[model samples]
Target: MAKTIQCTVVTPERKALDQTVDFVVLPLYDGEIGIAPDHAPLIGRLGYGEMRLRRGAEVSRFYVDGGFVQVVGNHITVLTAQAVPADDIDREAAQQQLDAARGQPASTDEQRQIRDRTVAQARGRLRVARQAHP
Candidate 1:
């Protein structure tokens, strides 16, 4: 059997997952990174995208808007500003949010920031959906 690493995914609201996983694919700001047990110690800034975790023959998917990943020894932890399981996301609601953000006027700095984040989250949600079905 392949060596496994302790993986944890967390957001401010809750701890999403904690398990021994064979491998993980994360969307860093630069690109996608594949990690496994005993991987070289590293840390990365994540972008809006999908995170894939594999354990044996099972795979789990999550959507992350943005965050950071830390790797040390046999442990990999992902801390994200926003995240949700792909299966738990509501596609229709996501689409509505995307549309609403797009329709809003570029009036204030705060509003623009929110709009940008909403778009990023929508894209991440879309990526997770595509990856989950593929």
Candidate 2:
């Protein structure tokens, strides 16, 4: 049997997930990072993308936006602004958000940055959902 580690995912509204997972892939600010049992302790800023957790043959996916991850001992905790399961994501709604973000005109740098982040988050949700289906 594969070894497992404690994994917890939380958002401002609620606790999204808490379980023992054999492996996990997180979306870091720079890129993706994979962790397993006994991984070195660390902390990192997260980005907009899919967070994948696996146990045996089953895989779970979530879309996370702008968070922080902490790894200590054999436990992994993710604190995110938002987290949505891939199966719960609405493709049409995500597409609409992406379109709206792209269509909006940004008058200032702050507006542009927010718009860009919104677009990225919407795209990430769509991507995760599509990947799960396809």
Candidate 3:
């Protein structure tokens, strides 16, 4: 049997997941990271991308918005603004959101920041949806 670790994912609205898994892979601000049993203690800033959890031969994927992650004593805790099942993401809707964000007026610095964040989020959702469907 494969060894596992406890993992919890939380958003402001609710707890997204609480399970034991064989392994995990999540996007960091700079890149992706894989966690296994006995992972070192650390904290990281998460990026907008996929969070994959593996249990035996089964793998589940989710689209996670920017947040933070912590690993300590064979447990992982994820605190994110948003988390959605990859299969639930709508490619068409994500694309439309990206387009809308692109068309948004970014004349001001604050507007530009919002537009950029929206664009990134929409793109991340679209990417996950495409991967799930493909």
Output the number of the lDDT-best candidate: 3
Q: Of 1 and 3, which scores higher on lDDT?
A: 3
How good is model 2 by TM-score?
Answer: 0.94
Index of the highest-TM-score prediction? 3
Candidate scoring better on lDDT of 1 and 2:
2
RMSD of each: 2.0, 1.2, 1.0
Model 2 regions more than 4 Å off:
none
Ordered from best to worst TM-score, the candidate numbers read: 3, 2, 1
Q: Per-residue lDDT tens digits of candidate 3, residues 20-111?
A: 99999999989999999999899999999999999989999999999999999889999999999998998888889889989999999999
Model 3 TM-score is 0.95
Question: What is the number of backbone collisions in each predicted candidate, taken in the order shown?
Answer: 0, 0, 0
Model 1's TM-score against the true structure? 0.85
State the lDDT of candidate 1 residue by residue for 1-134, as single tens digits.
66799998899989978999999999998889999889999989998888888988999888987899999999999999877788877777767777876887768998899788778777778767766654
Error of 3 at 57 (Å): 1.0
Give the clash count for model 1: 0
lDDT for model 2: 0.90
- lDDT (Cα, 0-100) at 2 in candidate 2: 63
